[model samples]
Every structure is written in structure tokens, then in C-alpha cells.
Target: MPRDPLSRLQWLVFALVSAVFTTVYIPQPVLPVLRQTFGVGEGTASLTVSAVVLGIALANLPFGALADRMAIRPILLTGGLVVAAAGVVSALAPTLPLLVGARFVQGLFVPALTTCLAAYLAKVMPAERLNVVMGSYVSATVVGGLSGRLLGGFVFPPGHWRWAFLVAAALLLAATLAAYVGLPVEDHEKARQAEGVRFRDVLFRHDLFRIYCVSAGGFFVFSSVFNYMPFYLHGAPFHWSTRAVTLLYLSYIVGVVAGPLAGRLSNRIGNGAAMVVGSLVFGAGLAVTLIPQGWAMALALALVCAGFFTIHASAAGALNRKLSTGRGRANAFYTLFYYLGGTAGITLSGHAYHLAGWHGVVALAAGVLLVPLSTGLVEMRLAQRDGSATRSSVARAR
Candidate 1:
């Protein structure tokens, strides 16, 4: 890999990741159209979305473990193309079940690309810069998700919704090619052997276990907020029109900026410090929703988006940095826990909203934030203690 190509590779990976995320969420905005077209009920139509989620949740760890022993660039390239192919098939499927299966296949392969890219980026980037770079990656994902949703609106009015999938696949294919051309090949093979690999190697660390928990916990709250807030906006004093409620998703634009900001802050102050700050920001956002005004709530949503991405970007860097080996597996675990938390958060928070309404949802989200904040403080202190001990050892040697 030449220096210039390598320099561009990070951005290429970011684009590749963004494309993957866009493909994953394309079905979300068009679910109603799918139901009408396929003549299926709501649950059956929604199976297209659920099937993909199920595939990613189940495949993260195994694909991550596989990345360690194999060539990541090829895996990423293959995954990207496979997802595109899935999109084409999904677009043309005659039956709902087949479309759901195609979406499932799309989910199955995407984790390969994401998990491997995280480990590969950790390997190649300067340690000090990795946090910011990872943040940029997270930001790309936000842009991708937002673009896919917006695409549904843009294409569904005149063109059929399937055009959205087709167009997204075309763009994703281009991204995959750029990544394939720009991504460097690994050359460390002659010396190192893969014979001693074991599952315990990646799963047994207490520090990592805590970080994984933090990853899952953070996403749980974030996802809960995003998934359920629409219900609140549609009801009550605000009583926003459906189109106005949809416009509220524009707040997610904050996430596109949040990732890089989180990265730079983490670079200056350390991942723990940045993450704690982000937690406070997010907690504040959640609290601000207590205000009765709609404009205030909108600002609150922006803060929450920024704060969550900031913390999430930091967590990714922390997970990658904690492991000298088995980085892939650690990332896999982090992603696995992340979605698990999201699943649990949406379900539990829905129940909370059901029983107690908006206030109950807020209370549950706030309570959940405390655990990660405490963990961040502990992690920061441990790093400081380690730094001081290293300095003392150096002084004694002198």
C-alpha cells in the first residue's frame, strides 16, 4: 500500500461502512408500501426488518473471530458486494418471505465488514488518532442511515420504493469498489501462526467485559429514545402532525457531527474523560425533555444525539485499544452487546411508556445512564493509576 492510497483508505472504509448501514435500514421507511404491495399484515411486512436484525445479532461474534484468521480486505469486499446483491434480490422478490430471506442474508454478511474494519483500523492507525478516526466511522454510519430513510421519501413518491433499494445498491457497489482498490493487504503471515486460537482468548477479560457492557448499555438508551420518541410526539400537548413528526428525525443530523467531535475530544482528554462528558451531555438532554415547550424538546433531542454518538465513538476506540490480540473478537462482542441492549431497551421502554407514559420512559433512560457513568469514572481512574505506576517504575530505574 502506497502512502497516498493508505491515507485515503480510512475514508474509503468509512464510506464502505456507511453504505452497509444504509442498506441495512432501507426497509424501515418503506414498510407500509411493502405491506400493501405484498398484501401482508403489519407483522408479516415487518418481518423484512426483523429478519435482518436477527441475522446480524447472531453472526457478529463468529464473523469477527473469522476475520482474525483470514484476510479482512477480501471479506469486506465480499460482504459489500453480497449486501448489494441482496438488495437487488430483495427488490425483485415475488413473495414477502423471499424478500425477508434476502434481507436476512444482507444482515448476515455486513457484520463481517464492520467488525473487520474496526480491527483493521485499530491495527493501522496511530494509537492517538484511532479514537477520532473511529468517530468519523461512526459519523459515516449516521449519514448512511439518514440517507436511506430520506431516500425512501425521495424515490417512493414518483418511483416505486424498490427504486430506493436499487439506487442504494448501486451506490454501495461503488463504495465497495473504492474500498477494494484503496484498502491495504495484510503482510504479516510468514511469522505468525493461527493454531492456538481459542474462544476464551477474547471473552475472558474483566476490563473488556465491562467495556462491552458499557457499549450495550449506551446503545440501549440511545435506541430506546429513537424508537419510542415518535409515539410521544404523535400524542399529547404537542400533538404534532405526522409529517411534522417525521421532520423531527432531522435531529439525527446532529449525529453526523457528533462522532468527529467525540473523537477529537477523546484524543485530547482520553476516551474515559470524553465518554463521561458525553454521558453528562446525554443525561442533560434527557432531563431537558421535562420542559413543556416543543422547541426545547427539539434542542434536547439534538443534545441527546450528539452526546450518544460521542460516547459511542469513545466506546469503540476503548474496545479496540484494550486488546493487544483478538481485537476482532472484542469488537464482535461489543457490537453483539450493543444490539442486544437496543432490543431490550426498546421492549422495556415500550412497557414503561405503556404503564407510565413519557415520564416513565425518561426515568428509565436516566436510571440506566448511571451505570455507564460509574464505569467510565472507574476506567479513567484505573488508567491514571497505571500511568503513575509506569512513571514511578521509570524513575526507580533511573
Candidate 2:
């Protein structure tokens, strides 16, 4: 068999998508700095982090539909440009409102990049390599996330917040150019000629509904922990500097190791089982973080990263394959819920933090994880029942 060219394209797409996502999250570590500099309250400052996610969630479905209609490359290019422009605008905004608006616009472009990129990869890659490639892409995203936080924290000391955005914009621009030059252009006419079912119908299916809920619930828990951890650490006995706090993102490397491994494991065991185990592990990891000590916190963060990546990798890959039609749309639906949860989780957890403190936040997160953990178990049982039914049918046919 000849080697697959699409696999290479998927790798490049992963890189480009990861870079764009990095630009969106670069403000996370600097949220407190923005609060102080802009003279805003903590709730308002947190909007700097939440707005982009809200934007991504709002745009995911539209962009996914667009990808089904248009060539993926053009959509991706436009998204990249819009995101970069938003970054520049955000870096230059003089007021909190203007910066928030720019961040929202930056987020709007995010789904275009991410949705198109994922769909493009799905269209190009072979089934055998799909999980591995997606795993790599997920790891790249984790790295981008880590880099974004580190850059924001390390670079924005006193008056250097703008530099963080500038650096992110530059990196995104470079990645965009690389993507434009390296990615293969899709043939629109051929894509149009290939017959497939409409995505709206796919949305109405019961099986997919379960999957979307699982994906969303899983991400909600994942984002809640990551988004609030720094805030929690900044408050307590640790009272770490921004740079010191951002260094916690170094734990994201655990996801880098776990993603591909989880993907491979999902291929062997059922994805439902993988998702269940991963969610359980993630919940346990969050439990570890309740220790209130720095070293224990570090260990808990590492476990959180591992568990998040494991569940996310498996669930996302399963989503791509679960649907018989409208794969792109399905993925978009997953992304929509995924990011929506992120936005909701961050905003809601902020309140939890205010009300009950770090313990409250952890409890809220664990409660959210339980939703997906329970869903995964249900999915596993359903899969087993289906398998038994199939075997019985085969026996009757024989």
C-alpha cells in the first residue's frame, strides 16, 4: 500500500489549528494583570478569559456548516487572518470594553480555524492513522495552551501585557503562512459531487445526542479546573507570582504523553470504556488537588492533565467515527458543546470560588465530572447490549 499524503496534511493542519487556539488563550494567565491595569473587578477581568471561549462556542456550528459548503483551506485562511487581526486589535485596545470586544472577535474566528482544520484532517487521513494523528493534534493543542499561558505570565510583568498579544499574533501569522503554503487545496466541485446526508438530520439522532452531551460535560469539568487553578493558587498560602503560577501549565506535558496513548487504547478497548475510565481518573485527580499544599497541588495538576487528555482524546476520536453522516457537522457540534462548557464552567466556577473557596470549586468540578462519568457507563452498557444483539442476529442468520 502506498503511503498516505493526507496524513502529512493532517499534521500540518494540527500545527496550524493549535497555533490559532494558542492566540485565543494567551490572555488567561494575564487576566489578573488586566484587572489591575484596567481597574476592573475580578468578575469583569475574568471576562477577558471567558469571552474568547464564548465566541468560539457561538461560531463553531456556523463554521462547521460552512466547511461542509466550502473548501476547507479558504475557510481556514480567512479564520487565521481574522484571528491575527483580532490579536493585533486586542493588543492595541485602550479600554477594557474595546479589549473585550476584540477578544470576542478573536474568538469568533477561532471556530473557523478549528472546525475547518478538524474536518479537513478527517477528510484526508486514513482510519488506521486517524487516532494517532488526532492524538498528536490534541497534544499540540496542549502545548499551545501551555505556551500561551507561560508567555502571558512571563512577558507581562508591569507594562508588557501588549507584548504577549503581539508575540501571539506573530506566532499565529507565521503558522497561518505555513498552513497556506503547505496545505493542499480541496477541490470544491468534487466535494460537491460526493453525496452525503445533511447535518441537521444528524443532529436529531438520539445516539449522537448522548455523545454530544458526554463531550460537553467532559470539557466543562476539564475547563473549570484549568481556568480556576491559577486564581485559587494566587489566593492561598502559596500566593505565587504570575510567572510562578503560570509555570503550573508545564504539567500540560502530561497530556502530551497521554493523548496518543489514550487514542491507541481507545482503538483496542471500546471508546466508551476508555472515556469512563478516563473520567474516573480525572475526578480522582481533581480530588488530589484538595490537599492545599504546593507539592500536592503540583501532583494533582499533573493527574488532572493526564486524565483530561485521556478522556478528551478518546471521546473526540469516538465522535468523529460515531456518526454515519455529517461527520464535520458532528465534530462541530462536539466542539460547540465542548467550548460552551468551557465558557460556562469558567464563569460558573468563578462564582463557586467566590462562595465556597477552592474546596467549593473542586466540589463543583467533581460534580460536573460525574455527569460524563455516568454517561460513559451508560454508553458502555448500551454498546455491550448492541454487541450482544448483533451476535444474536448473526446466529439467527446462520
Candidate 2 C-alpha lDDT tens digits along 1-398: 11576556666766776787678678777777787899986668878878998998998887776766677777777888888888999899999999999999988988777777777666656688766766656667877888787778875662587988887898888888778778766667644443276667767887787778777777788778877777778886778878887888788888778887888888888788888888888888888888778888788888888778777777777776776667766777777878888888888888897899888888888888876677678868988998999999999999
> Candidate 2 local accuracy as lDDT?
0.79
- Give lDDT tens digits, candidate 1, residues 103-187: 9898888787787788667666778877667766777788877776666544455237678789889989999888877766665
Off by over 4 Å in 1: 1-3, 27-50, 92-100, 119-136, 153-160, 181-197, 236-243, 267-270, 290-292, 353-357, 381-398
Q: Which ten residues in a row have the lowest lDDT in candidate 2?
A: 190-199
In the predicted model 1, the residue pairs found to clash are: none
TM-score winner among the candidates?
Answer: 2
Q: State the RMSD for candidate 2.
A: 2.9
Q: Residue 181: error of model 1 in Å?
A: 4.7
TM-score of each: 0.80, 0.91
Question: Cα lDDT for residue 395, model 2?
Answer: 100
